[model samples]
Target: MEIQHHVSLKHYNTFGLDITASELATIEHENDISILSEVPDFSTQSLLVLGGGSNVLFSGDYAGLVLKNNILGKEVLKQNEEFVWVRLGAGENWHQVVLWSIENGWGGIENLSLIPGTVGAAPMQNIGAYGVELSSVFEYLEAFELKTGKIAQFNTTDCDFGYRYSVFKGPLKQQFIITRVILKLSKHPTFNTSYGAVAQTLEEMGVEQLTIKDISSAVIKIRQSKLPDPAVIGNAGSFFKNPIVANETLNNLKTEYTNIPSYAFDNSYSKIPAGWLIEQCQWKGYRKGSIGVHAKQALVLVNYGGAKGRELVDLSKQIQASVQSRFGIELIPEVNIV
Candidate 1:
């Protein structure tokens, strides 16, 4: 294993914080995972496995060993008339996978087009966009247990996927490193365009016939128009998850705010848009010394340039506090702060 010390991680993360890792290693193959336990001070230092680094916020220099998952592959394991099972390596780029699926006429992840990050990370957070989520197509995933150094398989039920949450982020946090993801895509897909401006965007695009490719293009266009590109501007997509509040809380807010937007989460709960709450608090387009909330999307926290992770974390906390005070709904961060 090649280990580097004091490695700058600005490029690794989408937030572009110039943090350093105490030690860094690359997991380019499954064999690399077996010997990670033998690395210098492996048992003493904390371990962090990074995929595409699109969903993480480093609060400061990572005072631990950072392993970048570079193991890459995409293959169709099996296929029938209805479904095609595709297995991807942990490091496979998510959007590229969507494009690849579209090329092969496979459908399911088309609506998730342009979502940044890696395949292995998808199951951890149950990545979603438009009206579709990873759980709807997830088959299973293989992971390497850190303690045992053995590979184990987990099915959809075992994952326990919830809204932007999975068991990996909870009970099994830091216990295992996901290595592979298996998804069952459809040969003939049932398109979902009811979420957001997908249908409207498709109509504007002058698309008369709807296909998986058309939906992907529309979702990509909508995302591009609303979200700032990380390549040009530093951002980690939506920094906060929409808070799910009690139906009673929603009714109480409606009486005062009168324009509170919500979606049905369950019979007893409703999901409030975090962006609307932040915007109502006058945080949209708010910037302070190279760090601030994105103007177009309040859910995104961007680093204009030369900003520290600590500042980012502080801003997120402030936004959370503001929303909680104004609406009595606590906003949870979707970004994993390390």
Candidate 2:
């Protein structure tokens, strides 16, 4: 473990906002966390378990310890003709892991390629893309309870994954730090290309006989062309989650705005595209001072250099208010505002 004091968090988070942590430490191995309880100062200071920091917004200097989970490894735990169980350390870069699996001829995570964040945070948000979510491949996870300093393992059912939520974000919130995740992937893969622009992108590219690597490459290209790289412009990719509404509510909205885009979620509910709502309010190219919505993806709020976290939060609120006023729908922010 390497510890530092008075650390700047600008580089840690995708938002590139200037924030400070009172103390910061990096745990390079998963087992290293077992001894964290003996670090002497944890009980006295609040701690933050951080992965890639792609999903968080630090509103101000953290008056606590920021423990960056740097443990890294990937292993095939079990394999057979039909399926394989793979385990990943908490700190692995998510996209790198996807690429690794695809290169190894594994198929489950191909559609989820190019999502920003760490593997540990994947189960927490139920991170999904191109029509597949972490839940589809989830097997189990090992986490360390913060209070008791004990390790616990949870199965898929224990995760309680729904949409973009999980037990890790609710009943288990802040109580544990995920150290490893186990995922089950197929030996003979089934492709998932049902989500937005995937089939279209493939058709446009005149592709057939698609392999996992090809699908991942397609997603990577599409994402690169649309989303601004956080390395170039500061942003936490989609800032707000698409809100789900009752079927009747969606019908009413559609009656008023004929072009409203929605997808059915069973007979009772429909998921509304938050990006469309934000764009409907003409917020795509909207800007206020140092913060603004990304021109291409209205759901992504960007830091136009030198923006404070507070400014970003205020801008997000403004968009939320505008969308609610215009559409009678509440847009919930996806970024974890700290």
Top-lDDT candidate index: 1
TM-score of each: 0.98, 0.97
The CA lDDT at 50 in model 1 is 99
Lowest summed lDDT across 10 adjacent residues in model 1 is found at: 36-45
Give lDDT per model, in order. Answer: 0.93, 0.89
Q: Model 1: residues >4 Å from true position, as ranges?
A: none
lDDT of 2: 0.89
Q: Candidate 1 — which pairs collide?
A: none
lDDT of 1 by residue, 259-282 (tens): 889999989999999999999999
Instruction: Report the Cα lDDT for residue 314, model 1.
Output: 96
Clashes of each: 0, 0
Q: What lDDT is obtained when candidate 1 is compared to the true structure?
A: 0.93
Model 1, C-alpha of 149: deviation from truth (Å): 0.6
